[model samples]
Target: MPSSSVTISSKCTILPDRNSPIIKTTLKLSVSDLPMLSCHYIQKGVLLSSPPLPPDSLIPLLKRSLAATLSFFPPLAGRLSTDAAGHVHIVCNDAGVEFVHAKAKHLFVASILAPGADVPSCFKEFFVFDNTLSYAGHHMPLAGVQVTELADGVFIGCTVNHSVTDGTSFWNFFNTFAEVCRGDKKISKSPHFSRDTVFNSPAVLPLPAGGPSATFAGDEPLRERIFHFSRESILKLKLKANRKRVNTEILGKESNDGWRAVNGANGKANGAVNRTDEISSFQSLCGQLWRSVTRARKLDGSKTTTFRMAVNCRHRLEPRLEPLYFGNAIQSIPTVASIGELLSRDLHWGADRLHQNVVAHDAATVRRGVQDWESNPRLFPLGNFDGASITMGSSPRFPMYDNDFGWGRPLAVRSGKANKFDGKISAFPGRDGGGSVDLEVVLAPETMAGLENDVEFMQYVS
Candidate 1:
């Protein structure tokens, strides 16, 4: 608690109305949901312009919209529980979500939007979900929303336990809520809670595998900073990576030709680059961040450093689940490389490495990963991942700006308050909704200080 701390202005719970509509049965969670049992809630917030009405008018609107939205997405209003053998499931008891109304005296949306300004601490309080709510307690609300009014803007904070849903499902709920707020009688896409089809029975399968590791185990103090990458910069990176790919391809061809000339035989290069070798904006940004963080930490060249990424498995599954399928449907892709290889290689080298991991996760690959996970059910490997690791959550491709709750689009989308994971980074679309990207990175103070002055990294980031 420092002078820059946020104070609570008001607090209250918003229950689903008696007729708000809810599912009566308890929905069994798949083994896929077990790994996140102890991880912090998935929290996120956005700053929007204050509606052109009395500040108090916003609360009633939010409450009404939430009640309506919950009718379509009832699991969020349910509570989590565990059975005798420690299996977790959601009880659709209509327990309801918590809502809060607050004001930050000196905080303005612009102050928060300003470049390099310290992230306001009130975001955590604005979103009212409790990270400490355990399955044993049986009183936890799976989702909550909070709105904090600043002098010139408002912050909308939301928290959803990772066990209940993934990013795609999380944003789907918000989009539906926004639809309700705008007076739409129905949501565009109804959520499909078909957990049965997505995951096999737990009796036959072992415990779930690949959940988040214990709450960010690093002991070092962490600092967070938001960095913006313009559409132009991102394009330049993709173009550079492509050019590197072509050059590497050409060099490999030449080396193969030379080898053939020396020996009377034809040999293929180590997978020559093709049109399929193209990279994505996410891979490009992660490449830049992983390299900069490695150099900033000044990790020893001989040690192993890993870049852990979150992969969405909705469409990657064989009989792909519907776009609206609820609950955890994500897998982890951890790419490991020695510091010497990561730092000494060109940006495209990192970009290509990350891109390959993403490309390899087709339907068959996803099935195998899940099968292995069910067979072994281990915590998603963080690589004993310490300062030398870079973990990524969220994606720039997610429809972040579309959650228009009757007001203008949000100025920025940010990860929620419980973001304590070491070397964690969240990606959101830039405000323009173009190809630009916004990265929210968390690192140790010294590493953050080094990253701030990292000339190569800052060159691409605005």
Candidate 2:
């Protein structure tokens, strides 16, 4: 397809990573959907009890930081631009924030500034609608990020495109932002944006031109809408399932009684194994924990709905391959069954089904069938229906801790704040008490109330 040069700017404000061919591919595919996906970099600052720094004084530094960050990662200079025929393509330094616009007014952005600014409230308000680029993507940010400062507490945020980078990648740039602000040239790792392992199908058949358009119908059920579940609820459900046999009650023995009445109280482990040579011991443990949770659910269609975290294949798909793969490496693996269906079986039987889905996503299945899986809905059955729900989680096994910004550890840093969209789930560190993981499950107002009213959903109240 022929394309035109982008119109963001004449000068090359940003440059592409010379080593990344995948970056080239990402830029190419993003073109048709260009306007819909230009990335944004929002930098906010908090003033202490001293004084409020004028937005103008901040603008120069902000622009410099923005320019510096964009310099390190060249793709920021690129934009998905459209042509007269309405075909879109990528253009470097084509379009960017026209700060002169009213929407980009001197103080169009709200502040989390002390005495008056409320961080959470500001976030809620900003997130109530489509952000600056709302019309651009379904992944609208929290409407805006914030810079908060007060008597003792302090918090600053920057939220941007999920398509361009994962949560991990977002933090990568954020930490670097802090380093740059503090005048530290000591960056540990240079950014990687190569996607050698992620193969795009041909726009034609047999190949998966994996992108927004390639999304599968049946599998669409998984990503159509993802619902959040707190780790507390998961633990409660776990204990409820094992109430009869275990001494410690996550929900309570009575709760277990309710779970046990379903049917077959026992079954075989779903014959699945993930014993690859590269499987880290910790990943192996987490996998085992996931299997255990599935085992206890007893997905029988009436009580429990086993949940699974579908992983993006861009990173781990090929270890021998480069770390970066542009476009969506996101794959949906729903570890679930109809609510009524899950309640029919015992703990072990339910876990097996979940185990099967988990094991089914080995590198090869995803590599060999990525295109078919996303392109052929009837055959793969991914995007089959609308209003599907997914429960998401991450693996802490990868020696990946410390999202250390120059300020010290983010008193409490976490992602999964997806809002407006139905059935969205966000799980982070536990705010306080109990286990290592804390989950904040956000459902529709009705679904939340329903979960609250349901007998099976109220075990982990402590």
Say which candidate scores most in TM-score: 1
Report the lDDT tens digits of candidate 1 across residue range 282-395. 577678888999899987899989888777676666677786788877777778899998889888898788778776767787677767777776544432346588778776
Candidate 2 Cα lDDT to native: 0.35
**lDDT of all predictions:** 0.69, 0.35
Model 1 regions lying over 4 Å from their true place: 1-10, 18-22, 130-137, 203-213, 244-275, 380-384
Tens-digit lDDT string for candidate 2 (1-462): 111111211111222223323343434332111222322222222222212344444434444554455545554445444344433334434223222100111121222222211123232222111223312322222112333332233334454444344434444565565566545666654576543344433332221122233222111111211122343344444433333344455245433333121111011111123432222211222233333333333334344343435354543355533433333344556665665544444544444455455556666866655555335422112221334343443332111234333334444443323322333343343333232333334344454454444443334332
Error of 2 at 345 (Å): 3.4
